[model samples]
Target: MFLFKKNKDLLEQYTKYLELCAETLDIFRKAIAYSFENGLNEHFEVLAGKVHAMESDADDIRRQIERTMYEQSLLPESREDLLDIIERIDMVPNCADHLATLMTLQRTPINPALKSEIMELLDLAIESFKYTKEAAVDCFLKMEKVKGLKILIDNNESLGDKLEHKMIRTVFAENTGTGEKIIQKDMINQVGEICNLCEHVMDRIVICSIKRQL
Candidate 1:
């Protein structure tokens, strides 16, 4: 009974960590959108601070889980799976931090077309995080929803691909100055990379859910 309670507590902590990740992703998306649309440079700093806080929170959760496991002599049947999921969840915040830092360092307003593409990528990435959060929640209930999440993942991936192609075309066709073009390219790539990472985490969550079911 004590072991069962400890497992429940650990799962709860895991859920909280997922929620924090989702919140951090939302902040990241909004910060990028605001920067692109309103020329707000301060939002980037805010986003970075939030991501740092989220990372700290995730670390705390991880330590708590470790402590709980030790105290209770409890081990997950698939410790590696759980560890992987936790690491992925933590990675979301790290990615956000990277994006924010990149924006701060660049200190240049993005080209309109490139901004549009990045905004689209942020939207899709946020959506992917939403579905990932739902999938994580479903895990606790023993509900298998990988099919639904896979659909979202596919949709987001398609959006990312289209945006990438459009951005590349706009950059070269417009003959934008080489320096600015490179900056835009880097921004687009980072945003797209975030979406890709989100998809990877979702895939891992699907695996973790299936393992739990088995």
Candidate 2:
């Protein structure tokens, strides 16, 4: 009975860790949006600080989940699988962290047209994250749902790449200073990377579904 309870606690902590992924993504989403809108000012700094805090919180939850899993004495396969998934889930927030930190350094003001395009890209990336959370849930309770989500997440990934390319060209085409253009290009890359990482996580999830069925 005690072992069972311990295992149950680990499961609960895993769920909490999953929840933190969504939270971290949301914080990053807002921080990125604010940076685009406000141009990495003090307000943007405050938002970035929130992203930092959430990433730290997620880290704590991840460690707890790992330790609890180790102590609970689950089957080797099950423990390893959880660890793999959790590690991938952990990567999703890192994209956010990178974006929040990297963009603040650009500090170059965005023109209206480019800002609109970048906002669209950010929106699509956020949408991809929503799909990731959905895929994570379906992976846990309803593996059947994962296959369909894979298609959607893949499509989102493709869209994100196209937007990234378009924005990079847009950044270069703008009549900005050399340094500013370079910074904007890097910012665009970071924004697109968030979606790529989300797809990366979902791809692993789809495989986990297949493994579950096999």
Candidate 3:
């Protein structure tokens, strides 16, 4: 009975952390979209602030999870797998912060190709996170729903990969001059990395769920 109660509490805490992660991803997608649409340099500062706040929230959640895990003495069959899954979820916000920092440093106009691809990547990443959050919630409520959620998550990850590869090709092909090309390349890399991290988190979630099932 005590173990059941502890598991319930831990699951609640994990769900809260997942919600926080989803909120952070939503903020990131909005900020990225706004930046591209307006091309206003000032919005970069605001976006950076949002990313920083999300990062702080993620850190707090990580600490909370650690404390709960220790206190509850809830030992899973694969502790490392569980921790990796949690850490990847935490990393989404950190990667968002990195992307915002790149935006903050930009003073000139972004390449048209880069802008379009970045927005697509952000959209796919956001969708991936949405399904991941749903999967997490469903895990606690109805484990059967998780099977469909996993498929959606996988589809989003594939979209991200396609966007990233296309963006890389476009970045190299565009003649944005030497110095400008370097800057754009770095920015594109960071944005692509954010999508990659999102996929990583989704994959970890799927793995964690499978382990739980086994």
On lDDT, the leading prediction is 2
- Output the TM-score of candidate 2: 0.87
How badly does each model clash, as a count of residue pairs?
0, 0, 0
Kindly provide the TM-score of model 3 when superposed on the true structure, using C-alpha atoms.
0.82
Candidate with better lDDT, 1 vs 3: 1
What's model 2's overall lDDT?
A: 0.74
Instruction: Please report, in order, the local distance difference test score of every candidate based on alpha carbons.
Output: 0.71, 0.74, 0.69
TM-scores, each model vs. reference = 0.83, 0.87, 0.82
Q: In terms of TM-score, which candidate is strongest?
A: 2
Candidate 1 on 1-214: residue-level lDDT in tens? 1223447777777777777777777777767777767774666677667766776776787777667655555555555566666677667677877767777776766677676567777788778777877775565454667768778887888889789878877877776688887877776777777667777877887776776666
**Candidate closer to the true structure by lDDT (higher is better), 1 or 2:** 2
Q: Write the candidate numbers in order of decreasing lDDT.
A: 2, 1, 3
